[model samples]
Target chain A: MKNNTTLLRVITYVVLISTTSILINDIQEFNFEQFKSFASWSKSVNKNENWFTSKNAIMWSYYIIITALFFWRGYLIYGFTHFVSILKEIEKENYFSQKNINYFKKIGNVFITYTINVLVLQFLLSVIQGASFNFFKELKNEFTFLIPCGLAFYLLAEIFKRAKTLKEENDLTI
Target chain B: MPITVNLDVMLIKRKMKSKELAQKIGITTANLSILKSGKAKAIRFSTLEAICEALECQPSDILEYKP
Candidate 1:
């Protein structure tokens, strides 16, 4: 299990590095023509007409990145807090204290929040990519894809809520 | 769910105050209170052993089966 975890960590870093490299490449190759096409496409949609402009698109990307980073940090904070608590509980040899159960709930909450943020970003990226290429035919496809993401978010929230309730009961008993 | 704790009886027999027992056992009064009130979900064997040694009693003196 330890070896598998290390391998997973390595794979995650590799993926992150590759993704950052690709994003840098895309930013370097960015051109005014793409912006013009995107702006024109935005004008077609009443909801995001202003967002199609070059400046607005850049601002939108920044906003998305900021929101994503904030939530990502929140997820990390909750994850680390829960992890430390679990370690402390284990150190105290209090397995029946249900502290780890509370930590599991925290992990679930973080996972759900992070998953929702990623899903929203993916939806926005799909819409932006389709609009830039004038792919109106695939517009409905993006909205439909969000349904499962929403369901998964709801399921995770419910699971965490149940776990939290159990933890509370355990705490009360103690 | 209906387990019984005889912490109070043992403390009384030893003529030891809860606060003093807590201090001697390196645990907080709050935790000692929880144990005395039979609300503790679990207790570490080491903690149980320490309490028994400090009070010079057996586990049966501090814990009992009620259900």
Candidate 2:
């Protein structure tokens, strides 16, 4: 069991490090020049053109939506860090500890929040690109698994809470 | 929470030290302290029996219900 936990910890660390590096790389590769041009464009506005319908406005909206998606992805990664915290608790033989329960709940919150925000951003991106947004089609996409996964984490948290209570009762039994 | 332990009172009546009773009852001194302080959630029947045998008391002497 200890070996299994050690292996799991190693795997988690590897995934976390890789994901962080990838996110950082993506952020670095993002077009800050377009944002700068958008700022300049706002200063030299074409008075006759509708602001919302302009090409620059659509491009700026696209960048903003992309940035928001990246932020949510980073938040999701932060949520994964809680798994390491939980594993540390388990290693100390605190499987049903309050900290573990809280971490599980936190992970659930992050997952659901990330999924919802990403969905909203995707819808906005479609709108900016003059494309139709189908909510059901979007839900059928890659990130949809996170919704049920988040719920499962919540269920796990509740189970851990019950186990913690049972453990306390057992310990206090004399 | 209304249920209180009276183990200390019983111990005083029998003139037995808490540690000695714990040893006689085959429980840790720490656990005996939990019982004495009423921090234990529940007591096993076997442990109560052992305590009763060692302290020469009834369960009612060690446990009490207060309104």
Candidate 3:
């Protein structure tokens, strides 16, 4: 599973970098007047103007790549939770094997740290994009949604930490 | 790092099959097999006590110093 995750991370990075390069090229050659006309056409057809504005199809490619990145992040979180559960089961059997315990602890720490980093990055991006679009009302709404979601994620990490500690204590008791 | 379980001896002396003992102990047959094979990581104290009481034996009788 760890190997599989590493492979996925590598794939995600490759795709993101490639798509970002294409996006840069598109931005450099964009014709604002032509783009405005295209945007109006897109609006009339109820489609996303940004999706069709790029010459290299970077906009559509970026949409797909970013969605994949988010899904990968979700998969990582799921893997971490599964690992925590496995550790809990092992601990229940009073198996205090130090090496195994340390391995799990390290994984948990990494998961928590990465989760925080991702959330911060997401919040910053949301704020920057919203402000640029002058969408203050939408920004406020997003903040309301983000706060609870962030808290829930934090709470889950806390629960996993407490469970790990309790399992350690149980092992020591025996 | 080695420990010994005397579950088999207790069951044999009590004229009980592993399945019967497992049923009375309220654990699955698979877990009973784990205990019998000495492959179990650990056993709960409550479970140990129950096993001893049910088989009319002592903890020392069910678990031995394996060195």
Off by over 4 Å in 3: A1-34, A37-141, A144-148, A157-174, B1-3, B12-15, B38-46, B65-67
Q: lDDT of all the models against the reference?
A: 0.63, 0.89, 0.58
Clashing residue pairs in candidate 1 (N, C-alpha, C atoms within 3 angstroms) = none
TM-score of chain B, candidates 1 onward in order: 0.93, 0.95, 0.91
**Which 10 residues in a row give candidate 2 chain A its minimum summed lDDT?**
A49-58
Q: Where in model 1 is the C-alpha error above 4 Å?
A: A1-140, A162-174
Indicate whether candidate 1 or candidate 2 has the larger TM-score.
Answer: 2
| Fnat per candidate | 0.25, 1.00, 0.00
The B-chain TM-score of model 3 reads 0.91
TM-score for each candidate, following the candidate numbering: 0.41, 0.87, 0.36
The root-mean-square deviation over C-alpha atoms between each candidate and the true structure, in angstroms, is 10.0, 3.0, 14.6
- Report the error of model 3 at residue B56, Å: 3.3
* CA deviation > 4 Å runs, candidate 2: A24-60
User: Please, what are the lDDT tens digits per residue for candidate 3 over residues A25-98?
Assistant: 65576445645654575467544444454442543443444344344354344434444444444445533344
Encode model 1's per-residue lDDT on A24-123: one tens digit a residue.
5655764546456556756765773554678667656845654464345444444435545554565565543545655655665555565556556655
Give iRMSD, candidate 2.
0.3
Error of 2 at A165 (Å): 0.8
DockQ each candidate and list the results.
0.23, 0.94, 0.04
The alpha-carbon lDDT assigned to residue A1 of candidate 3 equals: 49
Q: Given candidate 2, what's the lDDT at residue A54?
A: 68
